[model samples]
Target chain A: MPIPLIQLAGVSKQYGDVRAVDDVTLELEPGEFFALLGPSGCGKTSLMRLVAGFETPDAGRVLIDGRDMQGVPPYRRPVNMMFQSYALFPHMSVERNIAFGLVQQGMAKGYIATRVAEMLRLVKLEGYGARRPEQLSGGQKQRVALARALAPRPKLLLLDEPLAALDRKLREETQFELMQVQRDLGIAFMLVTHDQDEAMAMAQRIALMRSGRIEQIGDARAIYERPASLFAAEFVGEINLFEGEVVQSGEGKFAIVQGGGRIALADDTPLPGPVRIAVRPERMVMSHLRAGSYAEFAGVIADMVWLGDLTVWRVRLSDGRLIRISRSNADAANAAFSRGDQVFVGFEAQSARMLLS
Target chain B: MSLVKKTRGVGDGGLAANLGRRLVLIVPYAWLILFFAIPFLIVVKISISVQRDGRPPYEPVFELADGFIGAWESVQKFSMESYAAIYADRIYGDAYISSVWIAALATLCTLLIGYPLALAMARAPRRWRSLLIVLAVAPFWTSFLIRIYAWIVILKDEGLLNHALISTGLISEPIHIYATQGAVLIGIVYSYLPFMILPLYNALEKQDTALVEAALDLGATPFAAFRQITWPLSMRGVIAGCLLVFIPAVGEYVIPDLLGSDEVLMIGRSLWDEFSTARNWPGAAAVATVLLVLLLVPIVAYQRSHLQTHGAAR
Candidate 1:
């Protein structure tokens, strides 16, 4: 669809004996906001650099709009990168910084002036043309860097942890602003971040990375609801895992927990002895009474935390197993259980997914 | 009311202390005026003093009634003769031109070799950078005369270069490289090469390499990035290196004396001849004055520009 604005095939980059990015193959549709999410040194930034032509892959190829970027340098490539530090030239004024790429491309002086003015307005930094980067606040500097990266109108824009430098509140505000700009321009934006919340908030789809390979790639809700692997589940969001073994294999398979507790599965998949079941905290329902409507286990409330709008309950099952459950403020009074109180935790069989470890 | 009275008394004491501090600051100012400023005035006084024809280069019993008149008449009357004589002589004219040309050429050569070396030093690995920097400046630590003498051995007709070339079959005979202008230029460039390298290395090394990358990311080619960002940003070092090499090269005497033939007569040698052989103090002073005047403008300009740039950056 839309010719897949950027295509990366077998893009592996090595640093000496260490492979920073291993055999990454992915594509982004035009105007899609794609995020490569991982922890630090997990090769997310390395992947972005490869796409921006800053680092050449030791093997494999990076293609932008069906053209192989073999010998092409960063300047010649039709991609622009916004560095994490903003990397604004301190010697130049705000206007000059934004106009740098246009000038380099040999655009007419008048046209550059007009385009730079328009960009400054787009970023809502109008009338700040004469101020240097040091004179601006953190958010202003971020806007200037964004304007500069967008000034050349490249086919693909790479953002390397663009909001990492901003404060929490400012970062949240700028995330929406960045999303708006990407939508307005209709350009493919590839964002690299170790921040899961940031990725979920901005990107249409995410490529979650680990070590040197893509762990999983899917839409935000799919990745969160159904992670294909343990690493993907742990990386994307908080999940309570119960280590167990498959005792029966059929349409309604069952798993025996470590301490003789049983969990029924919805679908039967061929599996060896050891397996793990992952379930979201909110999916597990907690009640003071034994409802007896679904798979249930008796537990004691170990700890409780009130997080303004939601209450968190940590419950230890009868078999010495601990599970976390979150209840919204609207449902806080339903159980009314505090620490050291007895409760029952239950979940639907279809809600929990089994992950092979 | 009591506290106010005490504070007022303290304020009076503070005023007295401030006055004492101001007086203490004037001490260096007075010393500078007496030692530096007054000596320059004395030189002006002596230069304008008239010398009688039969007297021992001094005027005694001169009329104070004609005070300003005598100073003017003496400057006009007692000689532009030295100036005229120096310019009329072909040897002095030739020496002046040769010295300027040689220094300019040496400065150019130093820039050509030192710029790239400095860039390499700047981009070198951090662990290897210190070693490279020390190697670039190690030659300056050795004795200057020994370095010049070493050059003499290397540039001789049957010396290292010629011998190497002849043995390699690149030359049929030992070329006459010694006691020539080319030899002098080699000696000048070699001796002062460190002076060029150190400043340029400092400037290039201090540059933030991110700026270069930023330029390239903005669509500038590698060479364009270097020309637009690296070169202009390192200009302070270039200017410093040029001045360091050019100033001393202009007045160089030893290298020319040891390395060049009799055909190369430099201003330094001319000044030496006027003072030692010709016994012409006024003529040598005149030559010294001219050289000093020629140098003072550029040095002042360089210092002013340097200060202006630093001030602007701040």
Candidate 2:
């Protein structure tokens, strides 16, 4: 395997009473797009800052290209960060801002000029070299900031909530621009974002942070379909959970019974206590006619919302438990169910996963 | 009935707003016309008039006449004798030259001292920044005369500064600082230190700290970051602080009178001698008018540049 471009080993940091970043160990390979995904105050930004050398870890080491970065100041570190605010120098022109790092490194004036010109074109901001930061629009300023950070061409680039300041349309467009830049440069990119959709769209792998610790790290599909804990399941996407007892745990698949519904899991282990069955909302089929092929659940549609792309159905079981099911509005017939219709919801055995705590 | 009332309300509101906007523009301008502009024109008129031994100590350059021809004849009687007299006397030249030099030096000293303090206050933790700022301008809360008097107690021959120097063996004997140019400079810097720091802090505090961090993240050293980013960005503050210190320091009367030696002559002291002691009102007016013309250029330039950049910022 190729050596990782950056490695964080059991890093931890705290501010007064709050543990901003607990023990987190992660690795990024060359040209890898990694994301630290969490909500505000969850320590994802702190972890990125630690790697950028803005904040030192209280314990543990941050390794950049296999070198210890303990005593290295932010200026000396090879890592660069694109600040969330963009932090473009208002007094400087776009060309000067991009050339700042090269000039600091004492690069030749001729070389620096060409490099700045190249960066402007890379971010699709050609012919905008002489404009001051205040003269640019929000999206234009963001592109200038990206060009500035990438001018030095460091081994790894750190981004702290880079897209949070942009409008929705601009953010979507910039996401692809950022990925293209990373691909063209062939450097590892680490981003911190509270937006799950952004993380899913951009990063190849995501580490979900919860109160300074990584709860789970995997691809979006793995994290969404196979959650290891209840927090992971609820955080990534919506799921309908049913608590039940595992009565038969002999085969690889365990059988769980709750109320009048029996669910068979494809993969499970014997649990010390009762287990819960987690089923994704879109996995279950809802219909007025009961299918006799599998163990089916009969429920009444308690509430319904006709969204433009999908229809959300709230199904109440015979035992008074409510389960949310979403069906695509692909056809008019699929969304014909009303709030008072009697419906039978059923899922395949492969879709139900046993959740044991 | 409601629709009629709403339309009338809207019309009245728009009319009231228009009147309010006009009032906002008129008040300050009217104040300037009444106080600053007329008095300045009167001074200019007196500066060109001949001095005489009378109650007003000068001849009126323009006196209202019975008709247009008489008014034209009266206006033609204006003299350049006062300006010629100022040009002939080397004392007036010396006073103007010395004031500019002394004020320039004092302004430089205040800037060198104020920039660091303002930067420190701006970079300090948010909670402590307010306290530091308050302490920096705390001397302004007291009476100006009392503040100057308080400095006398600290810089005297047997004062606390001399006593500490002697006690610490940093000096061999008491120095003659109370009646020297050093004393005058000390007083000017102490008095105007707040003026320098306040504007600098205002400018520096408004700057986003993330700019400095971005510089560092771009691989610029701490000092380089300061030179490339902080220094250029805070230049407006530096210019403002220098102007605040330099303009008033040139014509300072109280500090020079209290702290300066007999040899250190300034335009303010010269104007005072001509007005109060010698009672040459026209000559003093000429001196004041010349000084105003000299200072007006810089003030207008400063305002013009500020307007240009402030428009760009918006």
* Model 2 pairs whose backbones collide: none
User: Candidate 2 docking category?
Assistant: medium
lDDT of 2 at A251: 51
Cα deviation in Å at residue B27, candidate 1? Answer: 14
Q: Write the per-residue lDDT of candidate 2 for residues B1-314, one digit (tens) a residue.
A: 99999999999999999999999999999999999999998888888887788878887767655378776775787777777878999999999998998899999999999999999999899999989988998988999999888878888999888999999999989987887888889999999999999999999999999999999999999999999899989989999999999999999989988888778888999999988898877788889999988898889999999999888777
Among all candidates shown, the one with the greatest lDDT: 2
DockQ of 1: 0.46
* lDDT agreement of model 2 with the native: 0.88
- Segments in model 1 whose C-alpha atoms lie over 4 Å from true places: A249-251, A268-272, A290-304, A314-323, A332-335, A339-346, B1-98, B275-293, B307-314
Going through the candidates in the order shown, the clash numbers are 0, 0
List, residue by residue over B218-237, the lDDT tens digit for candidate 1. 89999988877789888889
lDDT assessment of candidate 1: 0.84
